[model samples]
Target: MATPQIHIVKVQKIYRTANREVHALQDIDLEIYAGEFVTFLGPSGCGKSTLLNAIGGFSLPTSGTLTVDGKAVTKPGPDRGMVFQEYALFPWMTVAQNIEFGMEIQDKPKDFIKTKAEELLTKLQLKDFRDRFPKELSGGMRQRVAIARVLALDPPIMLMDEPFGALDALTRRTLQDELIRIWSEFKKTICFVTHGIEESIYLSDRVVVMTYRPGTVKAIVPIDLPRPRHTTSPEFNELKNILGTMVMEEQSRHQKAELAGTTAD
Candidate 1:
């Protein structure tokens, strides 16, 4: 069997404030197989983003270990590419320039950077917008540029944190299809975080349900539906219902916890 692309073992994250400590993650243990797509599905503040950050080496866990491709992750590197909820494109740069930013920072050869940037622009269907600025493009088009920027690095693993959360329904759906197509064609390992149950089920090979804050894994639900899944299909709806129920239960439990805390205070 192929090695796992990303691995987490009993990871925990804690934050220190002036008056108190915050537990963002607790005992997160996950394994993302190489070339497979996985998603962390949970409500807001569930530490899904925290876990992704840990794997990307942008944040360190208070305890436990994170490994990618059998190497310990201690800092951010080009091997793992990240796309945030907002398009972090440079407004001053053209689309092609934004995509080449990483390469430039790494002092990569100009020929290689140009070739890779052009290739990604073509692959992501953004060749026509290569010279356009973020302000000149639609939200979906800007997101495509954001994704292509990360893809230009050719990371073995891609970490996406609600990259489509800002778009409208129709635009989000279009980007979803585009993402799946890119994933299928590139076969890169992806760990996507989202609050959308249907989106998780549609995009992931396995949907990992997480608990409320101080989060831990609630369940890892495997999606057996075939590619190009139709949301209206019975099988798809069934899976959706299952995931929706899990999320609802977690949310309810979290509300109860919050109420108890309030009453005690």
Candidate 2:
């Protein structure tokens, strides 16, 4: 078999506050092959975001290691593109300018940046909004700009943290389809983090379920359902139910642990 594009080996994360330290992640061993779409799904406070951050090099693990494309990740760079829950766009820049900002920072030639920005705008179906400010656009449009900005860099990997979490149901669904289309067309290795079980199942080749905080991998379920998945289909519901049960079980286990700690204290 070919080597996985992203390899995370026995990773752990610990956060230190004023008086104590908390373990946020434990022994997270994951491998994402090139062109695969994977998602981390769990309830609030799970380490889904942490794991995503670690992979993007926005944060470092306290122990173990993380590698992407055969190199260890120590800090953030243009090689991995990130899309956050918030749009994360510069308010002052127009859509086209924002998309070209990365290339500007890298001092890429003006013509190259312009061409790349236009290409990404076209690819993301945002060509008409190139002159608009982020504030002038709707939430979904702004997110499309955000995604285009990242794609303009031509990164090999994408780390998205609830990229659609803030949109309305209609907009979220629309963006989900757009995302899948983009993923299929580009074949970028993607690790998307979301709390929605159905959303995870719809977008991922495999779903990695995490335990509630002080999180660890509880289960990694392969979603073998046929593509162009339907939300109302019987097979889809069955897979959702199975994953839902596992998530609920993990949540219950975490709640019981919390209650026990309270009692002991």
Candidate 3:
């Protein structure tokens, strides 16, 4: 068997202010295989994003460890790429430049950077808009550029935090298909965070459900359905209902906490 591409063992994260401490994550244990796509599914304030942050090295856990390719992840590095819900493109730069930014920072040859940017622009269906700025593009177009920027870097793992959550339903579905196509071609190990149940089932090889505050893995459901999944189909609906039930249970806990003046996750 291939080695685990991303490993999380007993990971825990705590945030302490001057007074109170928030337990955001607990005992996260997962081994993501190379090229696999996994989604962290939970309601708002759950530790799904926290777990993604840990893997991206954006934040550290108070205990346990997260490793990629046998080495500990201590900081954000080239091996992992991140795509956020917000389009984090540089407003001053054109689409081409934004896509090439990471490569330029790495000091890769100028020709290689330019060539890669062109390839990604074409692949992401943004070749015509290469000269456009973020402000000039629509939400979906901007998001495509955001994803293209990360893709141009060619990281072995992609960490996405609700990258399509803000888009319209049609755009969201379109981008979901686009992302799956990209995943099939590039085969990057993906860890995506989302609260959408159908999105998780449609996109992931496994859905790791997270519980309320002081979140832990509540369940890990394997999505054994075939790709290009039809939401209207019986098999698809069945998977959705099963996963939705698990997710709603945790959401119910979150709602009860709100009534109790407790953690609202």
Which candidate has the highest lDDT of all?
3
RMSD of each: 2.2, 2.4, 1.2
Model 2 stretches with alpha carbons more than 4 Å out: 253-265
lDDT of 3 by residue, 155-177 (tens): 99999999999999999999999
Per residue, candidate 2 scores C-alpha lDDT tens digits across 65-115 of 899989999999888999989999998999999999999998999999988
Models sorted by lDDT, best on top: 3, 1, 2
Task: Tell me the tens digit of each residue's lDDT in model 1 across 1-265.
Answer: 6667788999999887767777779999888898899999998767899899998899988999889988999998888899889888899999999999998988999999989998999888899988988999988899999999888888888999999999999999999999999898888999999999999998999999999877899999999989899999999999989999999988887788777772111
What is candidate 3's CA lDDT for residue 153? 83
Best candidate according to TM-score: 3
Assess every candidate by TM-score: 0.94, 0.94, 0.97
**What's the true lDDT of residue 245 in model 3?**
88
Per-model C-alpha lDDT, please?
Answer: 0.90, 0.89, 0.91
lDDT of 1 at 230: 94
Candidate 3 worst ten-residue window by lDDT = 256-265
lDDT of model 3 at position 78: 68
Candidate 2: residue 27 lDDT (0-100): 91
lDDT of 2 at 93: 97
Clashes of each: 0, 0, 0
> What overall lDDT, based on C-alpha atoms, would model 3 receive against the true structure?
0.91
